[model samples]
Target: MNFYDFKFVFYLAISWCNLLEVDGITVAEQLKDVLMEGYDSSIRPVNNERDILIINISMNTMSVLTLDPAEETINFSSEFILQWKDEFLFWNKSDYNITWLKLKESFLWTPDTTVSTSIDTNYLIDASERYVSVKHDGTVRQSIYAVFTNLCDMNVDKFPYDQQTCMIKMGPWSYTTQEVTCIVGRDIAPNDTDFGDFHGNSEWDFEGIVSSVGETEDPDVNFTFSEVHFALTVKRRPQFYVWVLLIPTYIITVVCIFGLFTPTANHGLREERVNLGITTLLSSAVILQIVANAMPKTSELPLLGNFILAEIFVVAIGVLFAVLVLTLHQRAHTREWRPPAWMLWILRMTGSSKFLSRNITKIRHKSSTAERIHYTGEGAYLFKNLDESLQSVREYIQEEDRDYFRELTYVKFFDRLDFLLLFIFQVGNALVTLFLVKQ
Candidate 1:
């Protein structure tokens, strides 16, 4: 109970409290350990084997850059580059034919089942030889063609042609394997121009160069692509319409020409021939329109239409010629441009008229005593002079009337003139079209 005793008791109490605290700590620690062991034994750590490298990229937008056409050769490139959200493609030049990795699909009306079937160039190629040339050696560029469903109704000639939806296929050489993907871009419309004799239903076209940024069917892969160059050359696929129309038109045209030979003296013959010519011209024009409906319009002319028009012109000229000839024949009969007295005198002395009289006499003097003899010398000499004089008169009259005849020959002259004009125009057209269409 003294101070030391008190201190010792206090220390003992403190020690007891400390021991109790220690005991509590020990119990708590043991509980913690047991819980930790149970927790560790009951559940295992998760193993994540997710590949974070591969990602899917989508091209949903496209933009076309302005073209610089000052260069004799113009180049069009795209600003749309490939992008993946999570990870980028690990591409290599060796991993693929990067220089030619552009995507392209075979365009066949009917897919060839044979591996080695003679096929026209699947892709258009510009080369020195056009018809028989088939090779993979060519420059690459971006080019496209839009093929519509009903081309007959498409307003190809409308100014600033409205951009139309078309099936687009982009790729490489006829033999190269390609893979490409592009975002839907702005629609390309045709320019407005009034192409004379040219139908406005032209095929749509586009040209550019596409660079490959990644490989298809392979994720996280890249390849270098040669600029896939293209020159859109859309040929009008004649659905045999031009030919079908041409056959009937040509037949009718021939029939009209036959009308020209019909004798005008025949009842209503001249009127019928003129009517037939007009009808044939109109029919040919309609057929031409049908052809134009299937073709594109440009600031140019159509060769086939020109040819048909030329034919119509020829027929019209023939009709005019027939009318002129008939008028002249009637005038000659009325004017009495008969043989002159001097001409008759020379003819009689030559016995040419006498011989005619004798022939007539033979017919009229049937069963009568008439001596007939084939004389020469004087008779032959006179006959020759008479025939010569007759030929001279015919030539003189024709020459004297040459101017009037020429005036009347308007129909024939027009026929020839139309041929010349159309020929010159067509040649110019061919040159111009070649230049305009050249990519």
Candidate 2:
């Protein structure tokens, strides 16, 4: 074989292989080539440059990952359905021998739809391995699984009882309103029966959705962009906070209140009543910090925060009352020190005398009603002088005996004051709670 004969033989073999049909030459095989003939993916598939191409957008929620209160964002998985008429992608069914075609996403012109309010500020997470559906009538339908974190202007004013409305703000990134119009959410989750397909978040309840189509004016470019907003409202399930924060804090506050005032004396000695108040106050403060840490560092405080503050206030006030109690008990050691008239009256009126310690009750004033009131008052100075003068004549009225009487009188006074303050603390706590919860 000469050199020219060898070249002709190689060319003949290549030409024969091209005609041997590596793939079947059916209409399905040739449809893509004919559709792409002189096709431009960058150009909008419209008859006129100024004609508005209408895109219908809708979504079905697959699952919600979370509604992050601190980040002010929602993470969810969704299936977005987009449909539009592509004037350039159509063909005659008689010639193609097929009513529809599934072409690679790369083979067709698609809208550059972006999430305007997304934290990432990126286009939707379209299916990387998706096919664009084309009917003989030029209708294009595309669906993709999109998972994203969208910015939601969360108003947690009511906190656990709050419902937040967040939107998926979608729009053509480069197309003006004159070139495109979007219709959104009008037919969302059409097959969703009783939300059977929706996998909900454990911390939130998925409320219904609303949608609107509007134009967004960009002053910098002096043009209006078409926008579609699908707003979804979610309500918080407050049971978690109620259990972890509210119930525990309330129980702790009540326990601290009782620990502060309820007389549990050991052998006539005051126990660690002051320590109880201060310690519980610090614990409540720590709990408050926990609640704060769980939330974003916002200036406005939540209702739960206010409720914890009120608990701390009550505990602090209890501490103050505890200090007052110790002061009264200390001052009683002075022979001239006497409990005030109101303190004496409280003990008699509220029947809080029964709450006195076993040792205090044993030595408490006991006699006729008239003499009981008079003696419990710690008497005038002349009376003390009379008792001292009588001490010399009656050795039975010893100095230690007089001291015991004075100690008993003031200890009873301090106990009565504690009871009164406990009542005040409960009332104040209730009022503060009502106000915070109502807001």
Candidate 3:
């Protein structure tokens, strides 16, 4: 045959072979036949008596809905991926191009521990369809998307500045470690891409997540079962409490301090100062009640609780100081009462002459000198008569002495006490605020 004739023959043979077409359809049919042979959907795909089924588990947290410290529960949405090998679904990819099948159409068996241990079943909020993927080696991976409200033991001792660890536990319902094992799947960490889409929770911020696997002993069944645990770490966002509860309480407590400096000359002003102190104290109590209502009842006190207690103590001191000042004023006006000698010395040493009313100290000094002279019988008598004139002059001297004492007594003591208490409060409040905030 010539070159042209040989080329024609080759082309004809290639076309004939293409017409026969013995690849995809025939291979798929043969694979299906082999896969169906003696395959039982109800039985687990364990090859021999010693074979054990292993399920790889992983999760991708989608969003955090709520974290209720009072309820000791966390609500979140996540996608759980579980992968296992099924010998019945095995097929050579080179022979057949079928890489996966829909889970509804497949006859694969699944584990009983499909749901999380802490899942709230009554409110079943999962809204995802069951989807599966297959590998050439017969490994099947199924994904389940669920919204879970799970029980978590929260330690809220630091509340509002606290970090909490909440866990999602998954384990087999009836299978022991001997028959099946749950392992952490490869590449099973939280997806950072999903974090940007996280539902904004006003009270908490999502920190991160950790995954681990271990076996737990069931005493009732006398068996150890494998479980997969995922821990989600979240931090409490404290700005809300700082502004609403803490700042207001602190401001009210500090305002109570000013009541101590109110003027004692006017009884009405003194009464107003006392009333202001009482009002501030009641405001602090109301704030404390609000904080208490927000938190769960527990024996251990939270940091916020400690701060509220300190605020209450400070305000109570202010109220007591106000009452003491009022009592001193009333006593000075109604009756004569001398301060102890030691107290007088301390008051004189710490007293600021600049803060006192002009000429008040000079008047006090002159009064003191005149009283000493009168008691020593050094002052001249106004009249010569022994009984009648002496008695009349003595009555006038006593009336002047009483008026002088009333003018100097309460006002002087109150000024000194106000300065001392202000210093104490400023230092004490600073320390308390710093300690509580750092904690």
Measured by lDDT, the strongest candidate is 2
Tens-place lDDT digits, model 2, residues 1-439: 9999999999997876566435766566677788899999889999888789999987755567788888889887777778999999777897656888988887788998877887652236444567888998899998766677898877876776888888888878998888988987553343356543564589977775677887889898799999888887778889999899888888898888877777544213444877888889889989889878767778887779878988898888888877767666665563345545475675673343333322322222233455322323456666756755564455444444655665565556666666777778777777777787677
Flag clash pairs in model 2.
none
lDDT tens per residue, model 1, 1-439: 6899899899997886576456467433433343234233211111232332111121122222221111111112212112111111113334221322221222101111111111222323332222211112211222322111111123233212222222222321121123222222322223312211111232323322222222223234434221221112122333353456544655565566556554323323445555666777788778767646544654443555455555566666766755754454444334423333464453333232322121111112223234332348868877856755665676566554653443333333323333343354345434433443331
Off by over 4 Å in 1: 1-234, 237-239, 263-268, 292-297, 337-439
Top-scoring candidate (TM-score): 2
Candidate 1 global lDDT: 0.35
Scanning candidate 1 in windows of ten residues, the lowest lDDT window is: 108-117
Better of 1 and 3 by lDDT: 3
Q: Model 3 residue 414 lDDT?
A: 65
Q: Give me the runs in candidate 3 sitting further than 4 Å from their true place.
A: 1-38, 114-129, 186-200, 260-268, 349-409
Against the hidden reference, what TM-scores do the models get? 0.31, 0.79, 0.77
Estimate, for each residue in 1-439, the C-alpha lDDT of model 3 and write its tens digit.
9999999999997876565446644444555567768877678888874688999887754477888777888888777778899876876675556676454424457776645556573323332334466676889887666677888888878876999888778877788898889998532233366433333367777766677887789798699989898877878889999998888777777767765554334544677777777777778778777777777788876899889889878877877877786787676566544455576577773343322222222222223443443322443453323434555577667656656655665576767766777778867877898899898
Q: What's the lDDT for all of these models?
A: 0.35, 0.74, 0.69
Model 1 CA RMSD to the hidden true structure, in angstroms: 25.1
Name the weakest run of 10 consecutive residues (lDDT summed) in model 2: 357-366
Q: Of 2 and 3, which scores higher on lDDT?
A: 2
